[model samples]
Target: MPNLPDPLPWPEAVAPDTTAFARQAILNLNRTIFGFELFDRSLAQGTHTSASDAALLFNVLSHAECEVLMQRKIIFINCTHDTLASGHLELVPPERVVLELPPLDAPQRDDVETHLMALTDIRRRGFRLAFDQSVLTEPHLSWRPLASFIKIDISHASESELSAWVQMARQNPKARLIAEKVETEAQFAMAQDLGFTLFQGYWFAKPILLSGKTVRPAQAAIIQLINLVRQQASTAQIEDVLKRDPTLSFNLLRFINSAGFGLKHEITSFRHAVMMLGLKKLFRWAALLLTTSQGAGTSPAVANLAVVRGRLMELLAADSLTPEECDNAFVVGVFSMLDTLLGMPLAQAIEAIALPDTVVDALLHKQGLLAPYLELTVACENADDAMFAKASATLKLSSQQVNWAHLQALSWTETLVD
Candidate 1:
């Protein structure tokens, strides 16, 4: 991790508010959780930077892509202490949400009391309370009312410590146990034996390359169409490519007219859209469409997460680089997770996609102009401050900048998906 300069202020460009983003994020969460219960809270709202007026903000933020529609299970969401205290819980359906109590710290005694009071009230109303990141197994802590679920982390636990924790869980038969960071098959099996009903970890959603075979032929054609558009091919040439696939042509026309594009005139033909959007803009949008289309069978939240990463990286670099470079930064950010998105190897994905050398190097080799930036982004996502510091120092970025970028990522994600 290298030190970097202060993050630049947020850009004036506002992201569209749409339900599509939220649906995508929720779909992604579903895939990340294979058999265990999964829950979500906007990172921004969780940090208390914004108020969640809508209960479905989490769902909205998760579904920005078609991939989000693939999820089939229920996911719990956290309601902030403030929201609970304000009695907003009355407006929310308790059955759909699991109010998560903030961690108890020495300075938060009063806040904890208030939260507990709210939780008790809500539970009486048929809502459930969940305890997150519960590493403390003290008897005093254990005496607190049983939660609907308890989240535990074994990242730092020894075998003896884990066994003790498991024994403790057994002691509380009324509560459901969730093991987070179950990073290996062995860990997952152990958790299952411990009667843990839920799990989350990189092992379940490790980024991999997508083989061309996995992608439907229509999707592959869309990718080829995007490549042609990227080359500044003429409308006639682009139309010819699009005409080769009727399904894509129809979808493209529908998308262009939808509220997503807000086109004043309804364009019924693919060639007409190509002529109207011109080469550059057409290509940019085509790439987006292609990527999003691939999201149909995957988790939309994961795809939007990639988009958030790209937007944050680009915004962070806005002040230090040329517009062209900033665009490259955005490309580097989104494509950073291509392997995960494609369900293929990173090297293979890059080989298949004809991205610029800088983007290619950053994604595949992680040793080019944008590699450090990508590294910083990953560290931030994992909340590894030490790695963030190293990247900031190396990139000459300020802590404020880093913090701002992180916050913006959260904020942008909230707005885009929610």
Candidate 2:
């Protein structure tokens, strides 16, 4: 057996249940999530150790039910200067991931050189690299040529200082500069003016509400399908509604044929899909369709939040609610954010669908058998320790159960993307 070093101290961040992982989007200039930077929300409050980062990657990739991440977006992971030499990251395919190595605190070429062999090995194996703008200075400069991306904090420098930093970064023409903390349109533009095409921040996720806004016609068609599925309408009746929009029908076929369904053969038509999947399956698919139908303008972060909420709520209710009630709990979580997703108020957005009284009540008023589950799920997302303690006790659940369920929910949501 190999000897190991003493355990590294955990960062001061509030401890999360061992099962939970938090993911945030890394967006590009066009306001789309180019990648997800995942970390231990449980460990987020405190400074992170490279050990934690390695563990996060292992947890995210080990789950087989979901692809480790979105197909099109790369996943950026934090790496310690030391972890680079630990050989812990060899299990992950470098093409799909980037190691965000922090700049050397000071130029100790001996210290930096110790890991250079491993660093160059990972880069040779296809792993890209990201670092702060500081890497362009000092002994770290020796490490700069290996960088594929450099992130400059918009808030970290004064306007004049920022211009200098951007100017300095130009020396590394091979590296793409990323502007982080770009929260508003003006800053985003400033970053672009300075020549940054990649960005990270929440500017795009803010709700774009407008007065007198109602559901779009496309959204209306989706709502109608939800109602039909709820009523257990015949296939022909459901097909009539589906035929109204080729897009809705096309999305349905795509989902049915998705890896989630694991169909051995392709489903070519609506009727064939219906017969193969049955009405119960169709109803579940329709519910998912309605929840996810708001696209293009919708931020993936918002949609991802809704899915996590729905999955968490359903998981929390599993032990206490009937099978039918569990389904409603899931629906409540998924639709809880529909008002935000649709850009219409909750009352009006939900009014278009024929959801069960319990699901509708929980989403609208937060009162029903399922409402407690919704509140608990929100508490988990926010990491409200007091609320989590109270809700878990009131529901007669243990920390272990909640942790297990929360982790499972996150894993399940990851699978929903593809």
Candidate 3:
């Protein structure tokens, strides 16, 4: 590694677990984002241990936000051999994932065969495979045919060594070359000259850490309310649940009166919110609340951000979408932070409730009419001019309109906080 300057220290108040994930973009020759390699940011090597691999997969698949992430672009995940055989592997859509496996350490011939057997099963399951330079070594040669991507660490490889590996991988026809660890212009130029089509490392962009504290909800009250709402129970019974938990009641009223709901007046009572939203939307609101409920001492910043996203997307779509689609857009925006809010495996939270297919598509699949609005809201929040321009263009909205809605949403969130 070239001697890069040291990065600023992590904030003292930020817990290690808040360093939940780090995703480094993988770029194609044209320098577009092809996929991301996700890492456990807390890990020293940024690689997953067996347990963490399963946990990461669980988090990725279950979180509504992560679903949107996977739907748009492919992701490369580092895996231990044990993770290859994990049932969690079966849960992911094979086409959207590429499992990067390390080669055996000082493998015996039989050890190669054992690993190959696992790889074959996984490959048959439809996941593509990526390997380090060790795949070019003779012992691992039998495993070569299954490779869809071969990554060469350009930082370590001599020009002649890189040339040899590139030539060998080219012979396979199916295996594309990735120049990993390309931290400088010279390394990138060298790899490009050698015909590497995919590149990773600090040259294009460093890994971006996504952090969030897990939300732990007091579920009994919320679950009962959801059940009651699901059964189309009378408003009295539903109100009973809210009355039992003052915090839930407070949160419900706060959310209902928020600008995104478009209420003509404040909904100070639980029964009023139910009557206004009707059963369908009321249920979604409650289900969403299940995840948003945070324990004491936990910051409300994430939930507040979620509401801002919800309202921003709603305002952006108000001119373009129907009432129902606008509401779905709000759900997509709020639930976009589902993984961080729920704190548990996403599967657990999502499986317990039902969402409209359109909301599901926008939240989980990043597809449907509302998805672009959600994307625009995020772009606006991040102040990403390029993405903001692209998403606004896709939706055919002017920048002035989006900026106005964004400022309005932030201002509205302040009211909720106060």
Worst 10 residues of 2 by lDDT: 1-10
Candidate 2 on 1-418: residue-level lDDT in tens? 0111222223233134343454557777666668876645445345576677676677566654226345667888777777776677777777888889876655456577766777788788898999888787876777787889998889656778888988888888889999887766678788888889888765554334434766777778878877887888888988887788888888778877776666788998888877877776676666666667665566666677777787777778877889889888888888887866787777777887888899988877878788778777776665455666677778887655665566666656666643
Clashing pairs in 3: none
Model 1, span 1-418: residue lDDT tens? 0112334454332232211111112212234433223222223323441145343434333433211322343445544556655655555445655555557676665455455566677678886666754524432254246477776786667666777776766655666776767666567667666667766655443454456646567757866776776566677878887888887787667656766565677998777888766765565555545444544445554565676677677777777777777777777776666666666666765565567788778877788788888887776655455666688788897654554465555455434312
Worst 10 residues of 3 by lDDT: 1-10
Cα displacement (angstroms), candidate 3, residue 15, comes to 13
Where model 1 places Cα greater than 4 Å from the true spot, the runs are 1-29, 32-141, 154-176, 184-198, 203-206, 209-213, 260-262, 294-297, 403-418
After TM-score superposition, what is the CA distance of residue 16 in candidate 2 from its true location, in Å? Answer: 12
lDDT of each: 0.58, 0.72, 0.69
Judging by TM-score against the true structure, name the best candidate.
2
Per-residue lDDT of 163-194 in model 3, one digit per residue for the tens? 99898888778999999988766798899999
Query: What does the lDDT come to for candidate 3?
Result: 0.69
Query: TM-scores across all candidates?
Result: 0.64, 0.69, 0.46
RMSD list, candidates in order: 8.9, 8.2, 20.1
